[model samples]
Target: MFGSLGLPELLILLAIVVLIFGVNKLPKLGKGLGEGIRNFKSSVRTEEKTASDENGQDATKDANNT
Candidate 1:
């Protein structure tokens, strides 16, 4: 596993990325990545909320029937 990369290793990786993608594209790539992660997190939160609501309804029904 990648233990924390030291500063030199980090700079090397960054240099490679810049070479591959070019400096101008890096900002666009970073923005897209940020948006993707944000959307993923929001979707996960929504699914969790829906699941919890369904569980609550089931529990209430069981309690009423008892």
Candidate 2:
């Protein structure tokens, strides 16, 4: 997935993150990342539901016409 990052570049990025957050905080950071992903998924599902509801209403109107 990280096709653009060579070994040195990846190491540099990791070093920066480690410096900023430290080793002890990585787990907490991971948990927060997971929560963020879950929230995003839920938001996407809600948007899909709203769009489907609108489409269903339109379909019902079309059926009524026929």
**Which clashing pairs does model 2 show?**
none
What is the TM-score of candidate 1? Answer: 0.86
Which one is best on TM-score?
1
Candidate 2 runs further than 4 Å off: 1-3
Model 1 per-residue lDDT at 30: 98
TM-score of each predicted structure versus truth: 0.86, 0.77
The residue-by-residue lDDT of candidate 1 on 1-66, one tens digit each, is 568788899999999999999999999999999999999999999999999999999999999999
Pairs of residues at least 3 apart in sequence or in different chains that clash in candidate 1: none
Backbone clash count, each prediction separately: 0, 0
Give all candidates' CA lDDT scores: 0.97, 0.97
Which digits, one per residue and each the tens of the lDDT, describe model 2 over residues 3-63?
9889999999989999999999989998999999999999999999999999999999999
